[model samples]
Target chain A: MVIKVENLTKRYGDLIALDNFNLEVNHGEIFGLLGPNGSGKTTAINCILSLLKYDKGTVKIYNKPMAPDAYDIKEKIGLVMQNVAVFEELTVYENVDYFCGLYIKNKKLRLKLVEEAIDFVGISYYKDFYPKMLSGGLLRRLNIACGIAHQPKLIIFDEPTVAVDPQSRINILEGIQKLNKAGATIIYTSHYMEEVEQICTRIGIMDKGRIIAIGTKEELKDMISSGEKITVELFSMDNKILEDIKGLPHIVSAEYRDNSLIVRSSKGKNNLVSVLDYLKSNDIDFGRIYSEPPTLNDVFLEITGKELRD
Target chain B: MFLHNYIYRLKCIIRDKEFLFWTLLFPIILATLFNFAFSNITEAEKFTRLNIAVVDNEEFRQNTALQRAIKAAANSSGDKDQEGLFNIRYTSKEEGDKLLEDREIEGYIYLDNGIKLVVKESGLSQSIIKGFMDHFMQLSSTLETIIRKDPQSMERGILDKAEAAINYLKEVAPSKSSPDIVVNYFYNLIAMACMYGGFWGLKEVTVIQANLSSQGARINIAPIHKFKIFIVCVLAAVTVQLFEILLLLAYLALVLKISFGNQIGYIIFTCIVGTITGVTFGAFVASVVKKGEGVKIGILIGSSMTMSFLAGMMYDKMKYIISTKVPVIGYLNPANLITDCFYSLYYYGINTRFFINIGVLCVFIVFFSLCTYLILRRQKYASL
Candidate 1:
């Protein structure tokens, strides 16, 4: 295992942030920790990195227990916190070199790594510019460059694409995938479920200081009663017709709003044909219809009631 | 590996504007004020009064000899600015008691015979007048002897004596000479403003308060050892402070004539010590405040100025008072020891106390630096 956390429990006076949290990340796996805001995602990452003290738990990296004084393991681990971290005074290249130098002592090697980090983040043009002089997207890219310039085996990224433009977000996601391909174990955390669905191989949804569910995107989709979401745009919608439509078998939910009807179904077994037949038998008119499997958000809302579980 | 980080720390400090303002500029401005301008006397110039009556029943009261003497008797440096020194009351003995009881005056002087100065013995000004009167009496007795001995001049009247004194003054004129004043500094032999460096060295002090000093909190998590990090921070401070001292001393010596005699190297050495002292103090300040408190102005003011004062920066008498009341304060006062050591080299010669100043200054640097290390050591990164 690249990173293993067991029975991790952390308390701050009267508040318990992490309760018996456990996970084992294999090498080169993109492990995603998905949660709502304040669900102890950052807290868990902090404890595993020894940036916080845990009352009861064992955080091991490379089979060794992690502690604040574990410089050897810390040297090989890169943490890009939820908040962007880099020296404002230094240029992009200098910032990368400084952090990278902490691990790679060789001057020539550090210089090459720093250049690669800048190029990898698509911030090559801003290599000599200070962080303050850069735009938000460029600054975020620089933050990543500084963290990953060390090229550690285990790299943790906490909401790296936050406040970024679409282009920058795509670049960051691609860069993360490339890093994973290059044999780096990535521990990714984000509130954006779509992004997790796009990149994460295995997802872990946490709520109220506990892991509510953990699995692949498809596995998580199967766990919920809502199998798929079907949106149909009709010329007109009726109240009794929507109720009549909701009464159909395997039709988990139905709603009519803005001249459109939305139907939710569980265990997709030809519910679309059944729904079409029911609509035609009722002589209900519709223009167009579209269908998609349940997204990660639906799985998240199903497992952990979305009533502010944080 | 650490050197790269250390250099980065240096760059961070140099680029920090607020840190630069507090650590360097603040102290230099205060130092300039202390050195170039200061008020020595205050509160003592506020005044009370002196009441007295002059009388001579002797027939010579109208004599020119006594009249000339009376004018001369009132002659004093302060008396030259008329309406000052005394409020003369020409009254008889009968009014003396009434004036005293009515609180018209604190004392009464009945100048009968030679001169009898009477007082209520309740006020402080009485002693001042008494002292002045006693001194006047001795001079008058001497004058009488001179007059009696020169029987020929006595016939020519008191103006003749006055002329004679003026003639004597003209014959023996006070002369001016450029004395060789060699200066020897005790602590900072180089006359460096190293103490000024502490102001800038404490720039990282802002980091402790809030990460607002910078958007990123990378230094807190950087891989360098805490002590080594602190040392690097101080080195950056020293770089700035040393640059300042070099400029200051060079200007003071080449342009302003703050002579260091032949001990220029010694002055520089001591200045380096002062810089170390300043940087160490800066670290301590950084440890406590997380931002410079305008270069420890309250301490720099209280310590430096008082040191300058006790070391004759203000007045020599103040040195006596400080040495009497607080010896440690005097010894620890860098300016006091420095000026005294230099003054010894300038006016007298190098003494054992000079080395003592240098040694104590070194001790201050060591102690302050250790304090800075201990403080920086306590800062742990618990993701806090």
Candidate 2:
């Protein structure tokens, strides 16, 4: 295991930030901790990094206990915070060089690593620019370059794409994948289910300081009974038709609004076919029809009874 | 590693324009304004010999002792180096009256049973003349009493002895340098500049504590020990602060022509110590306050300004007031101690007082550093 947080618990006065939180990230998997804004994702990351004091339990990295003074363990870990953390006084190249120097002592090797990190983030053109002179997207890229310049064995990105523009967000996600391919284990945290679904090999859905579910995206989708959602555009639909569609086999719920009949069904291979057959049998006039596999949001909603973004 | 961190830290501090403006340019500008405001008063304070007349009556002529004293005073006026107390003109009583009334002389001295001084009004020059006459009369009276009690005592060279005693009683300055009261303001300005170094110290602490800033968090996550980074950052702060102080000192001495005495080595030493104290004080404040960086900075600035004010940066007499009335505060305040170091150097040369001030400043540095360490040693924060 690259990171093993067992029964970790932390409290801020009466509020529990992490309650018996347990997570084990393997050597080469992109483990995503998915949660909403205040779901204790950051608190758990801080605890795991030994940047914060936990009320109970332990965090181990690379089979060694984590601590504030654990230099050996810390040497192999890189952290890109949710907020941009580069020095405003330093230029892009200088900022990267300063942070990289912390880990790599050799002047020649540090220089090369800083240049590569800046290029990796696609910010080499703005190397001479100070952080304040850069746009928001470029500043975030500079922050990433500073964090990843030393090329540690494991990297933790805590909501790195928050408030980022779409283009930069895609660029950052792709960079993480490249780092993973380069053999660094990654721990990515975010509330954006699409982001986790897009890159994360395995994800833990967190709510109220606890992981409600943890599995691969496909496995998580399978945990929920709700499966494919079928929608059919109709000129008009009576309540009788909607109730009859709801009574179909494997159909969990059905509703008609805005001249469309939307039906949610339990996991079944022929659910979409059954919904279409019922629509034709009722002689319902339909224009367009489509079906979507269950999303992470649906799995979250089914398990937690709340939206992922809540 | 230390050198690498120190170099980058130095670069960051040097590029902080707002901090540089306050720590470097502000003192220079205030010194220039002070020079403009004090130049005229300093010039007016230069002493000029007072003019007085002696009535050429038989009483004045018969008094050979008074004649010799008057001749000596007149002779001393001819010398360029030593200042003369009086300019005497011998005239008839009628001419003496005319000179006094016409304002040609400040006062007329006539030997009536003893020396009597007449002046138009009471002022510094008039008071000086009266004081001189009173001393002469008192010495003459004492000599007469001694002669009447022991007539043969004169053969023992009593007159020469009295003259030697009078010469011994003449006022002597405490130091070779001129004690310009206005120079205290410059000392206070330098003290304020030293305290401004707290800003650099504050910045160092702000950027190193994970709970304080995101940059701090990033630094905390690094493999190196946090204290190592802190030491490097403090070295950078001290280096920049010392350079700024030396630059301010040079501006005051060379550009503004303000003399802080001839003790160049001691002045630099004081600046070095003051810079360290300023930075350490800032770090102490940053560590103790559980607030945002803005609040910590505000407190540092407010505390520094208050210390400067109490040390007489705003009013010269305030330093004396604090020193005499609240002596503990005078000894405890770092600004006051730094100011006194320069003040003692200017007025007393390198004496025990100067060493005492320097010692107190060193103590302040140790105290601040210890407090900061006590507060920051936890390493891991309960919250960020």
TM-score of 2: 0.88
Q: Model 1: residues >4 Å from true position, as ranges?
A: A307-310, B26-201, B204-224, B255-263, B288-383
Score every model by TM-score. 0.73, 0.88
- In candidate 1, what are the lDDT values of residues B1-384, reduced to their tens digit? 557756877787678776566445554554455434422222345453455545434533655444454454444434434333455555666776788778776665554444576776644677777776675567567768877888666677764554334423333312221232122222232322454455565554444322323222344444445566566667766877776666666655675455555666665665676667767765565555533355454554354444444555335466567768988876877656655555444444455776787788778778877776675555433334
Residue A127 displacement (Å), model 2: 0.9
Output the lDDT of residue A99, model 1. Answer: 75
| Model 2, C-alpha of A2: deviation from truth (Å) | 0.8
Window of ten residues with lowest summed lDDT in model 1 chain A: A301-310
C-alpha RMSD values across all candidates: 8.6, 4.2
What fnat does each of the candidate structures reach?
0.39, 0.82
